[model samples]
Target: MIGPTMTPEILARITAARAARDLSDLARQAVGTTAETISPAERIKRARRMRQMVNAYLDTVVVAEALAGADWSEITEALGRREPDTVEGEYADAVAEWSDAAEAEADAAADVEELDAWYARHREDHDPDLEKPVADLLNRH
Candidate 1:
């Protein structure tokens, strides 16, 4: 019998498949790294970049997976089991570490904005140029 076609479900499945493939490739690369020309720091930088790439790829993958109506737990479970701790766990921890630093930077930026706005309101208007331009336009008004 011909099966019914579901667009969202099909699309999500495709997205998940692509995400899994990308994650798998990354895991393979991470595992394959050994004592070679590249140092740990370099490897980590490369790994971080790869993780970012995978995360970007997952942005689409996640949306598509949601549209497909797949269970979140199932997806996570599948990824967890397939990826293993060494790959997925390490990558996740590294991303989390970076995310924490980024959040702190964002908080500092917000504080700076608040301070700037406060100072802008309290600061005296000390600009003769502001009047000069107007004075030049209206010489006898």
Candidate 2:
């Protein structure tokens, strides 16, 4: 994640924006349909599910942008100026680090439908959520 943008206010804003987007989607989906028949509980559950999905998706985009927006020198350094080490040992250490981080993420993300909500907070989705180069890099994959 881009360090400074992660905050409680940002996360709350994201949740609000997701509600806006989901309502916008629901309005479209409800056209000439029986969506009005859904119970309030079901509607809330659906929104929660949608928020979780969007949060996970935006988290992925942020990570991708963090990579694509970086120069090679920065990327290499961020990966930890590699020293000679066993791939297995490095992999094990990385897993341990990620596991700890994942646990923290899980604590933040009580909304995720399943495991691996690596980062929380859905995005507000203003156009150009990511930079042009970053978007292009992601689109390629």
Indicate the residue-level lDDT of 141 in model 2.
Answer: 39
Clash pairs, candidate 1, are none
The Cα error of candidate 2 at residue 63, in Å, is 0.9
lDDT of 2 by residue, 1-141 (tens): 222322332233333333445555655564644547878887778668666766554443333333234343443355555532332243344334433343343333433221112122333466334333222322343
Model 1 C-alpha lDDT per residue in residues 1-141, reported as the tens digit of each score: 112322433333333444555566677677787655787789889889787877766655544444444555555665654544443443444344433343343333334333334334434567232322211222321
TM-score of 1: 0.37
Query: In order, what lDDT does every prediction score?
Result: 0.46, 0.40
- Candidate 2 residue pairs in backbone clash: none
Worst 10 residues of 2 by lDDT: 111-120
Stretch of 10 with least lDDT, candidate 1:
132-141
The alpha-carbon root-mean-square deviation between model 2 and the true structure, to one decimal in Å, is: 15.7
Show where candidate 1 strays beyond 4 Å: 1-6, 68-141
